[model samples]
Target: MSAATDRTATLYRMVMPQHTCPFGLKAKALLEREGYTVDDHWLKTREETDAFKAENGVRTTPQTFIAGERVGGYDDLRRHFGKPVADPKAVTYKPVIAIFAMAALMALAASWAAFGTLAPVRAGEWFIAIAMCLLAVQKLRDVESFSNMFLGYDLLAQRWVPYAYVYPFAEAAAGVLMISGALMWVSIPLAFVIGTIGAVSVFKAVYVDKRELKCACVGGDSNVPLGFVSLTENLMMVAMAIWMLRYVF
Candidate 1:
């Protein structure tokens, strides 16, 4: 209603993404009517959408906030006037724990599941997983990566190239070294890196693993869910990194 209020600041909202979801459109219309600016995250990917919900604690479409206060969705936005929003409690970012945890977990799993130790594996899976594990260990240990668990939103990892391009090759290489009786010492470190990278690749799913995003690390044939599994996998990698530190320099 007042010029000072209009000039103070604007609110932002997020919409549950669909093929051109109307909820977002309606919310935008309402904001405009109230002389408020509307920002849209589009809710395209689960990571983005989940982050939105986590930050706001709301899950429905057309989530709204003025300045900093959550004003609810479309209906809620229509009710609020152009006003500076009350700031919510601050959210902290913690990536080190996530990264190391993921590495440790994946290392453990790769040592066993991927390498026929923890859970039983088919002959093919065993052969493949062993090699995969060996290289994973090596990759995890020595790669010159500065990213935390999720690769810090790298486009390469988001597109699955790190996994498809880097991981499979590392896994296959580790597998060969083991089957062919190559240098165990060299192979151990190499496998550690491989496992670490593999884990990071999985955690990087937070970037591109949308609801419809299919995984590419397992030759289009994986049995893992998208969200929590990706996170847990990262924690596994972090653990593995710690494990490998005992062996690798």
Candidate 2:
């Protein structure tokens, strides 16, 4: 056998009838990927698992050992190998990505129903409209929270607090109106103004000030960072407004 394949690692993981630990399986996979031969030890029962933890004085299972030294849990194993382990509290773009993905699917469905085909241009239009409506819904769910977060960066909202409160309603109204391709006079201008302001706010807060902040786009409870996703949301609205304006004129 090759020296890489001969490198040995040890792991202890729970594999009970009621609960099977996934981390243990992952750790074994990771060890194999790194060319280590894993001596996997399974704790088959709850009592056995508890007893193992107690014996080792460790609270969690899927404990790893390398060269007769403890390497800790799954995250610890990752850290040992210099792999990136994500912090649970860290802000990410996952929520926004999910929202956009769902919005795109919805747009595709709508386009298919209306045109009997997956019209790319029409789908794009519906995507922006649907995305705006969904984002507005998230804001409307907790206006107070949205406003408080919004004030952190929004130029107008910081200067005039009432704009923060009105923002969600305007977004919702514009989105709804745009979806039906009606009330261009009101929706177009509202989308344009808010989109411009939002893009500027995100840019200033994230780039200019170098401030790490949560995006208000997915609501106050979101961990979505205030950056590309937020800017994309605003840019979508701006593009939609311009596209709709051209149709009106």
lDDT of 2 by residue, 1-249 (tens): 556544998899998888889999889999899889898899999898889999999999899988888999999999999999998898778878888899999999999999999999889888998889988899999999999888888999999999999999999999889888888899999999999999998999999999988889988788888888889889888989999977787
Residue 98 shift from truth in candidate 2, angstroms: 0.7
The digit string of per-residue lDDT tens for model 1 on 45-157 reads 66776776777777676676565566676556555655444323332122323434454455456556545665532332333334345434534453433123323333455
TM-score, prediction 2: 0.67
Best by TM-score: 2
After the best TM-score superposition of candidate 1, give how far the Cα of residue 134 lies from its true spot, in angstroms.
12
How many clashes show up per model? 44, 0
RMSD of each: 16.2, 4.7
Where does candidate 2 have its weakest 10-residue lDDT segment? 1-10
Off by over 4 Å in 2: 1-87
Model 1 residue 221 CA deviation (Å) reads: 4.5
The 10 consecutive residues of candidate 1 with the worst lDDT sum are: 215-224
Tell how far residue 183 is off in model 1, in angstroms.
2.3
Candidate 2 lDDT at 249 equals 72
- Candidate 1: misplaced stretches above 4 Å? 1-163, 176-181, 207-212, 221-223, 228-249
| Local error of candidate 1 at residue 76 (angstroms) | 47
lDDT, residue 127, candidate 2: 90
